[model samples]
Target: MSDWRASREAVELARLGVSELLANVAKHTASRRCGLRLVRVGADVVVQVFDESKQLPVVRTPDWCSEDGRGLWLLREMADGFGYMPIPLVTDTSYRLGKVVWFSCWGALPEAGAA
Candidate 1:
């Protein structure tokens, strides 16, 4: 198995991003169940959250007075890139339409490729 891991900052950001996404799931969707994946590509780490809800996330302008709606906007500013896309979810019975929200950040160790 690969021992690769993201940098501390990257991991921290990923944690925050995941928390916000899961919170959205709990507040906006009927089901809170979802899938999470972390993948490393070169010097970057990608975090993906898959949910059965077909509704995509929107980046809203920050309203300091508001309690919500700042998660995506803040994430976009902190992450190298962030976006969402429709995806096919596999199940025992049939395919379901869902979405994968993802963000990428630079995190690999400088000696990642070194012996």
Candidate 2:
């Protein structure tokens, strides 16, 4: 495992992102259950949350009086890059989506996607 002490901020951001992602899952997914998959690519980490919602996540501008709708907003601020992909599963009542969130710090100097 890599030492996250040097990049605690990124880890913390990932934590926050994951929290909001999961919360969104609970609130939006057509199904009651959701699954999360995390993978490490070089010095970066990618987090993907799969749910039954046929709709994709939207990064919306939060209303001033709203207490929610700021999850992906915070995630974009914390991630190096974010991606959304539709899963190719054959189903009628359920669908799967792939959300990719990457951390800027997590690997060694030469492995962190630096030039």
lDDT per residue (tens digit) for residues 1-112 in model 2: 2352335665666677678778887787667566677676666666677665557778877786897777787677657777665665546785545433233334422355
How high is the CA lDDT of each candidate model? 0.82, 0.62
Candidate 1 residue-wise lDDT, 24-107, digit = tens = 888877777899898877677888998888888888788899977899899999999899999998989999889999988874
List where candidate 2 sits over 4 angstroms from the true fold. 1-6, 90-115
Model number with the top TM-score = 1
TM-score of each: 0.88, 0.70
Shift in Å, residue 64, candidate 2: 2.5
Q: For model 1, state the Cα shift of residue 66 in Å.
A: 0.8
The whole-model C-alpha lDDT of candidate 2 against the native structure comes to 0.62
